[model samples]
Target chain A: MEESPTIYEQIRTSGYSRRDFLKFCAWVTAFMGIEASGIGNVVRAMETKHRLPVVWFHFQECTCCSESFLRSSHPIVAEIILDKLSLAYTETLQAAAGYQAEEVLYNTMKKYKGEYLMLVEGSVPTDNDGVYCCIAGKTSLDIVKEAAEGAKAIISWGSCASNGCIQAANPNPTGATPIHKIIKNKPIINVPGCPPIGEVMAGVIVYLLTFDRIPELDGMGRPKAFYSRRIHDTCYRRPNYDAGLFVESFDDESARKGYCLYKMGCKGPVTYNACAVTKWNNGVSYPIKSGHPCIGCSEENFWDNGPFYQHLASFPGFGIETTADDIGLAVGAVTVAGIAAHAVRANIKKRKLINADIEESKKEGGE
Target chain B: MEDQKIKRVYVWEIPVRIYHWLNALVVVTLAVTGYLIGNPLAIQSSAEAYLGYWFGTVRFIHFVAAFIFFFNFLFRIYWGFAGNKYADWKNFIPYTKKYIRECYDVLKLDILHIKVKPFISVGHNALAGLTYFLTFLAFLFQSITGFGMYSAMSDSFFPKLFAWVVPFLGGDFAVRQWHHLMMWFFIIFAVVHVYIVFYHDYVERRGVLSSMAGGWKFIEKDKPT
Candidate 1:
């Protein structure tokens, strides 16, 4: 192994200082929800470890994932994640073009075979020999397969790469397919979202660096730590949900009260992601916090779930019992009806007894 | 015994009664607020016309009521074991064969419009008892899922305890939809309850409405068991 260089030395040589390096590490630790004690491990890894060789590929996508990553507020994210990491080849970010870019990709594949990480953005189109999406006269499907053959691990960025997003929504023209659906042999981690929260992206990378392996994932291949809870679970407006307060319209009194947007077609209850707690724009606020209902963008096939603003009456939960919309309506209506019926039933019995007593009193008086 | 003598028998303990009424109140509030929120039928204007928050007030009241409802839930559970015999598990469950017979008789009479008068229990009748039992079960369901959703934040004890519901219910999306729909059941239940109470009071000429308030329901001597 090559001798490891200290991060401060690396950053200083790259024109940064010890304080700046430590601050960046602390920020990373906070973002990742790691303990203060874990800071040492993070620092050590960054200082001694050589940047992992990464090959980023773009397929049938709008390049939003790249845009979201670059928009990350943490300067170190750009400085270290982009600058320090050995990003060997990326079609969007790379300056070299034509044969030069192709040469760099080939050289990296040969030099770090079965060692480099493969990052895929967007979906792979498989229609007509994958003619819909191509790079340098080669189909995206062909390129992905060739590059994936020697990758150590694959990370599917955003819903496009993770679940095909809108490209695979309905009547898919390009036959857009998620990475795992096409290539299942290699270990894959899906970071799903509509341009997933920036911190989440950063956190995933940090976890990989610190643990030297992929984080535990749910059955869908999403990291369990970040994707386990629904956005409804962590929403700031959740109290309104439990209380049964809801916004009737975008301009109603309840909406002003910051009631749960659930009734207004907020998909938070069903969607899982870290947007509510971790938030966006640097932990400042999320869509729900800003009074917008969750579109459930983090979930797979969110594009086809339904219209964004129509409320769903009921759905099955964990099969504990169906809390159907009609059930609530039934209970509400039945409780009142049942109570009144019982009251009437009781009265009829009571009146019969009172009338009988009156007759007995009259008889005794006559006797 | 002296004529016109009155004796008081405890029908509901303090917490039990408190929980009962407050739960009723919140469920009603939730149904109303939930209805407005879900359909937004009450709103006639555009989203931007009213400061961008359409049903904000209803939702606020709904949440406040829900808080009260959950609080009542905690008390109800405690009272089930700690309450009087009339308010305990024995009263809440429909286990006896006699109770089953009463329910059958009542149903038959309703369908046939039979005129036979019968003796009635001071407590909730068989049918009423069963409905209450189911409502209790519904309350339990609501509370579990309610906290399950709440547990998402605070990472509180309840969400972890009830985490199993997530998978069993399919996913969070389904769980949430069920939660919203259940509100409608409560709404329909409330409407029917009111209609039946007033209808009986008018036709039977008995102080049935006062029984809950005064806790004494007098019966005529001719009534047969």
Candidate 2:
């Protein structure tokens, strides 16, 4: 087959007008947090560069990442970006099956060796000879290592691929491990939501396509452009949080008024994601906007952190539903009971000593 | 009884007494407010969302107490260096052979409940001194983790100094867990500390409780200086 056309040619052939293309470029540039001056650079890159080949892999995940990516609200994002990308092989999206799919993946890896981008969407299990998750009779660990060796960079999509998600929660039976931990040599960028925002995913791809390099990453290797700030920092109900107003429960008046969900165990304060600033479903509303607390899905081991409905106080794995008050009250009761018991013992010991002293004095008086 | 002579030894200085009471107050404030901050009460208020700052007030009290606790701890450290021999930094550490011996003696008398003659000290008993040392270390841990969590929400330079601690310890969730756990440590320490002080006052007859308030401890004149 002839070499694939540049993104500009693909967009033009797809019936997108020049104005529409430039508008998309500007929109992506802004989404990438690039200044207005950088719009020309983004457009130029798109016009000149051929789409990069991506081998999307799945190990042990729910395919929510791909679902979220396909559901990108932007028309061009879903239509142009996903379609235009040289997605050589993806288990979920690829039409080929069995040997044909494996052949495509091998071909992409060989043809674009050290050039293709590897997008991993799930965690690789390391226990029991990696029998928990496998593809084509090859364990995920073997696949990830083999793919990562030749890829230019790896994009760990979603929490499963980033931090093991619920699969890596306490007592992880399969011993599921994230991609970054498995592949240490490659420059891995983690997009760590349960299902990262579709726009954010698109923005990361656009950034890589435009800049020809991975975006700036935070300490946890997430794109700083989107994951730099906590959800609470940009939450609309922050004023209510500062004023100590919170939703007491799901059906309460405060919930109707859309009060802050901090009291309802919102993990927004600790969770770093673009959900608050870039609301999901085409900026319609996010979890907090819908009067539900943030479950902190993007955070590492968030499932093991605590329950979704309770605050963070009852942490340290006492129980799923136990709150801080329960622990405190129990400890307080124990302390009181222990102290009372000690006090009673002390009183008995003192009385014994006094009686012994009285008996000794009486004997001395008789003598 | 009339012939018995008592010598009033000034062990805790005014600074030590002040630090003790202030530290106690700050610990109580931090425990209650910290618990409330961790697990806030569901206050059903008829007031507007903007008008109710109750939780914020609880957080404010916690932060303020944390600050006071931190600085008071710092002042105590300073006084430990500058204060008299009894309040010296050296007293807190069990470096010398004497301190170790005293520790054994006190353990035998108090915890072990042995009938051995108590070896009296002018200042803190070696065991008490060691316990205080451990509590001080716990205080430092709480300060670092507490300020680390606060750094995210605070704009202050001081709290920001501890900002690195959160990422260094993994994340805010872990830091909060540790900070909460340390609060319980303080509560347990307070209970044991107060009980031990009273127990020593009864058994040793050393005015251990009053000594913290008045800076003086009554020692038998015949006892070795």
Residue runs of model 1 more than 4 Å from their true location after superposition:
A1-43, A51-156, A160-190, A211-294, A299-301, A304-306, A310-367, B1-16, B32-64, B81-102, B111-122, B153-176, B199-207, B220-225
Q: Write the per-residue lDDT of candidate 2 for residues B103-165, one digit (tens) a residue.
A: 998777566555566357888778889989999899999999999888767777999898788
lDDT against the true structure, each candidate: 0.72, 0.84
Each prediction's RMSD to truth: 8.7, 4.0
Off by over 4 Å in 2: A1-4, A313-320, A344-367, B1-4, B94-101, B155-158, B167-170
Please give the DockQ score of every candidate, comma-separated: 0.20, 0.42
Error of 2 at B57 (Å): 3.0
lDDT value for candidate 2?
0.84
What's the alpha carbon RMSD for model 2? 4.0
